[model samples]
Target: MEHILHVTLPEATARAGKEIDQLTVIMDMQGLGLKHLSPSWLSLVGEAVTVIESNYPEVLGACFVINAPPLFSRLYSLVKPLLSKATQEKVQVLDSNYPETLLQHCDAESLPAVYGGSLIDPDGDPSCPSRICWAGPVPDSQINQSKQPHAPPPVIRVALSRSASAQSLGSSEQFSVVEVARGGQRDIPVGFLPVGVELSWCVVVFAKSFLSCL
Candidate 1:
């Protein structure tokens, strides 16, 4: 329910947009909603809804505006007309029974501890950490200082065969002979190969390498 917005574009802008769309679809399917629990609704700027509505309008299952002060009502009225009918319908203003309302839609195990859910007890449990929601922009200095270059993910190389046999040099017995029945395939485990590592080895040429298999 915590709506923590990070106002920074990722390095790969193209992929980030695609990922945002994917996350929107996923959240919509999961019946997740945004909980605006801020004391003041000033943080609910135009940019917040603009990105979501522009990219994946259907992603938002619901929007629960809770703990909004009386001042927010005027602002809300102004913005209500701006939003589409479908989006406006999804917004629920719950002045009281905030926890109970969220419980109706979400399981206790899934809800946060502060909202009467059993996710974790931050005080009693050492592993569980909790914090109050902060709706603000991260300082540019902090962002630049905390930034670190990301490394590419590891590549998993798989060699498939209908039937294959192998025997070590100077060994009498054949080792790692895997066979697959018709309309089926097998995954042969190759020992740990780290990232940026190239594996090259000679294998007995029992069958020609097929592009389809590769």
Candidate 2:
């Protein structure tokens, strides 16, 4: 099956290594026919909805993360309805501010974990901006601990890049698809650090197969 890994980043967090980490994981998951999709907070404006609908036609479902600057609640309310019928029904949106809250509301078995941060460095430092730390197989213990009886295996982590040009650390050999969302109303500049930054937020996408892996 053809799988694609789509990454989205605001202008600010484009250089954050965490974004690369998330994308790597999503790309790895593509083997199972899973596609990862993310929309920028800046693109949550009125007209951008049509753009998303047209561009992401094959997106079976998506996981929305709010990691950038606060968006106008009105904008969030406005653009939500414009989602494609399929996307609206299958999409799962989450808030970076509250990972635990998002976890509690959704069935963990149905999603994959999406994690990223500006602190990670992809280079030798292991602490550079836009660095991807873990892209291959996840630890069995970690998988078992998160698994439940009846649900699918959850995605471990998916990353976002603020800009397509952000430096990417780690091997891109495994990634099949890399998505970038740029040119938006709010330009959030991401920080690139010599050392790794602390991970502040995460969005996990739960899928049925993920549970079987556990």
- Prediction-by-prediction clash tally: 0, 40
lDDT of 2: 0.39
RMSD of each: 18.3, 26.3
lDDT for predicted candidate 1 compared with the true structure = 0.51
The positional error of residue 99 in candidate 1, measured at the CA in angstroms, is 1.2
TM-score of each: 0.40, 0.28
Q: Which candidate leads in lDDT?
A: 1
Most accurate candidate by TM-score:
1
Model 2 lowest lDDT segment of ten? 21-30
Q: What is the lDDT of residue 8 in candidate 2?
A: 47
lDDT of 2 by residue, 42-87 (tens): 4544456586567645543345444433342444466667776676
Give the alpha carbon lDDT tens digit for every residue of 82-118 in model 1. Answer: 5778888888877556778777766677566655567
Report lDDT per candidate.
0.51, 0.39
